[model samples]
Target chain A: MGKRLEGDGRGGVEQDLLRHDCSIGEILKQRGVSRRDFLRFCSAMTAAMALPASFAPRVAQALDQVKRPTLVWLEMQSCTGDTEALLRSANPTVAEIVLEILSVDYHETIMAAAGHQAEGALDKAIADFKGNYICVIEGSISTKDGGIYGTTGGKTHLERARQVCGGALATIAVGTCAAYGGIAAASPNPTGAVGVMEAVPGTTVINLPGCPVNADNLTATIVHYLVFGKIPALDSHGRPLFAYGKRIHDNCERRPHFDAGQYVEQWGDDGHRKGFCLYKMGCKGPATFHNCPSQRYNEKTSWPIAAGHPCAGCSEPHFWDTMSPMYKRLPNVPGFGIEQTADKIGLGLVVGAGAAFAVHGALNALRRDKEPNEDTREG
Target chain B: MSNQPKFKRYIWELPVRWCHWVNMACIVILSVSGFFIGNPVSFGSSASDFTMGWIRFIHFTAAYLFAVSVMSRVIWSFIGNKYSSWREFFPLMTDAGRKKTVRMLRYYLLIDKEVPETVGHNPLATAAYVVLFGIYSVMILTGFALYAQHAPQGSMHKALGFMYVLFSDQGMRLAHHISMWFIFGFVINHIYSAWLMDIKEHGGEISSMFSGYKFTVKKEE
Candidate 1:
């Protein structure tokens, strides 16, 4: 807040100057990307957002005119797997193109600047852009004992997050850790880690939760913001509805096999080799919501199901806790411990109740036979 | 035949009987289909039939019927007659009703041999029915909430989509499954108690649900 760059006020003039000064069209042209390819990528973005074909040109025009928004990516209690996934762009596709559109101010893993220079770059970007820059938070914020678990440039990740996110437009919480505490906040969370929304109260946190969030979703989310000047419409979980709207079971490639009642009971049977439904073997696809089926990872190469492995429900909240044991169906009903399923517990109760009922019925019959005046009661 | 000493009293109305039977059928179908849906067991490799699809269809269809019958029962409780009215569902509304509940509990426990006299359900039965209705609401809400995930946005499915917000979809599924077991327990106990009461009281209690009439012994004052 030191140097308030003509931010909230003079919005129209700032937009015009920013667009005119450093246009994405010029940047892409310098990078040898043609207009037709750019337009095609815009259409792809529109399709990814579940928007109609007519909105493609609008997306293209908005993207072509907008300046590269400054982004400050902060990693807290993370594995840096999200950044690794982003860097592992399988092919020269739309995701890579979108990634290049953002002018990353400070990223711990990728940036050359470090020490005071890295902190200086973050401060400069926040001060210069004010309420216009984007804050991309990866991993969970360790709030235990004043966030001593994670630090950078002599400042705790929590302090740096609050400082940078104070004047940002919106924060994109990338990966499961940043969204819902992922594996870091699983049962007996040692560091008291929490998602960005919990760490930064007022910031509009758009969660793109996954073990290492699908690169396509990350690209689409950023493009949606660059085009519309706001984050895409989110579900109750703060995830973009287009990507996480439908359950993995609903849009599964193995759904036909599931409908036909063909399931792979074990890991290497003929059914498993034939790519049958993995529901029986504890595939959490039915309970999980993600676009991994349509939006396959690694440049449209092969998703988990196509690779003959069951989905782990990585994109969901508390997946580590709820969808554990990875290869089976049904969640562990908390008090039942990790080994027991709800069916097992329910069956036990039902059997016990049935046995008790039979005993009670026999006792009633004996009591009835013992009574001499039973006939008098009935007319 | 004309000098019969028995007296017959009409207890359940037609609407109440219809709702009861419809709900009973739906519960049977829903529970069977629901069990299969959760844990799909192989029924041979029948190439022609879509086993899981048909199972889910039957499950959803029965679920809708169950919801409708439950809703109808709620409406009927307000208008159906004194015997089938909402007041009968809450027997603890009066002081005498509370005493009747204790007496019925004692009767079931074998502490009292004399069955509590009631035209419809005893106070204990009324209380159990009320609790069962609460379980019905949970199943219906969670069922629709799960259905809402596949439904088009802004529809009635979306309107009841708050279950996902309150708990994860699996949590909703857990509630639905647990409630099914509760209904199963209720059904077993209900049948056992009805038969036991009929034999002990000699009031034609079990037949009352089907025929809407119970024969009671006439007493000379």
Candidate 2:
């Protein structure tokens, strides 16, 4: 790895100091964090990554000796919810410490620099860590109208993404917006926002798509990268397999209830109070892929389904269109009226066919009876 | 009509009739079970009841049978008699087939008082079967895609996960669900047409599916 420090001073000597030379272990030691706590964090990450417990030591060793890599966080057309989720991670102290060890050279939200200085820092970081830094994109890149929909520092998100993500070692699209355009690219998308992979084509983008991505998944991804020196295995959608290999329905706590056909029909019902399955209430868990059931949100407290609200399939692509009406089991058939569902349209066609056939049969009977002497010849 | 000698012609083979009834039974079971899977009937107040599980089991079992029947029928289309040949499905490929199809269309539209008879399926019915097969293909693919979710990391998951690239999970379910109605529509028309032809043509059209033979006038050589 290139360890050269470009000491062009926009900041002090402290900012110029080469922190990449320091291993994660040394930094954690300096921060008064116990070795046991560090190992526990590593084991937690290993477990989160669905690795065998025997691999904990390997993960711990790799993370301990690994040098801090440069990370550049790009916030485009987003709500900054991913960043908030990361800050409120399950193991906040350990996660924050691990994040701190990584040289996050450019982040718009949390960076101390402003205006031109911030822009300069971003450019400098990209230049210094070209082909090495991990670029984490948080929001969708608006591509319509020459990308005038979203611009920062006189540069369109598309332009900035192409430049920054094009050179990174690997790009992690952190939220649904950056992964699959989320709500911003919902129906009637005026901005024409697209995911980071679509915006910066051919770049190795590992998507961690959630409404606000689970901080644990992001943390596990970073740990996996640090430990393995490469990104984890990804699904077809480019999501890490460990975090998104199974449907939420498969691992859900209320799965037993679903199999037992005990569903909460409505809000505040007897079944709801008894912790029945939310399948009837239009839970999208069957369609959604996420570890939210196992790895709960907001510091492992409670996820949407666990809290009696059905999953809105926030992790899925085009979920705003495909996974709605959020309160219904199936999406309404497109090209049909908004209220007309697939079942309604299907039932109508079946009934119409039945009725038409009935009428035709009736007509054939009447014609045959009226013309009893009609020739039954094969022409 | 009284002087004509009626010849018993073998139109449907044993395998053809077997696959037809098998396919029919599977479609009916799959449709009913599949519909229930999509919109489960909430029953049994106790959590011990395995209603959805039983429903899903029936759906999956019917799905496998449907798959096998479809596959075998497709295979038979290659090796079976010319009547059940794969070429028969593509009726628009031949000039006579096109003419027959037009005649059948005219008869259905009441523009023509009579339609030319054939040994095997009429060109119009063959065309409809082709579309139904297309719907069957969509249903099977979408059904397998949905089933793949149950076995993540299994071979089925690996083989069928590409469906997500074509459609979202719920979209796949919708395709499978809507195709059920297409089958229902086809069944309605198919039954009525068969019944009508049996009555008007003096051929055992509906019974031919059961006996694999139809009564036709002998063409004197």
Best by DockQ: 2
- The list of candidate 2 runs beyond 4 A from truth reads A1-16, A368-379, B1-5, B219-221
- For model 1, residues A1-379, the per-residue Cα lDDT tens digits are 1111212122222332354357777777766777887888888778778789999999989988888887878888889998888877665545446655776666877765567766766777788889988889999988899999888787887897898788888898999999988888998889888888888888888999998888778878988988887788898788999899888888999988888888887889988888888888888887788888888887668899998999998998988887777776666677877677777777887888889989988876656332213342323
Question: Each prediction's TM-score against the native?
Answer: 0.91, 0.93
lDDT (Cα, 0-100) at A235 in candidate 2: 82
- What fraction of the correct interface contacts does each predicted structure contain? 0.37, 0.60
For candidate 2, give the lDDT of residue A222.
89
Can you write out model 2's per-residue Cα lDDT over A1-379, one digit (the tens) per residue? 1111112233332453376789988877866778888888888788889999999999989978998888889999999999888865666566656565677787787776678888888888888879998999999999999999999999999999999999999999999999999889998899999999898899999999998999888888988999998899988889999999989999999998898888898899989999999998999999999999988887678999999999999998889989999999888888897889887898899899888888877766655221112243332
- In model 1, the runs with Cα more than 4 Å from the true position are A1-20, A34-37, A93-96, A368-379, B1-4, B43-49, B218-221
Model 1 lDDT at residue B219: 42
**Candidate 2 global CA lDDT score:** 0.84
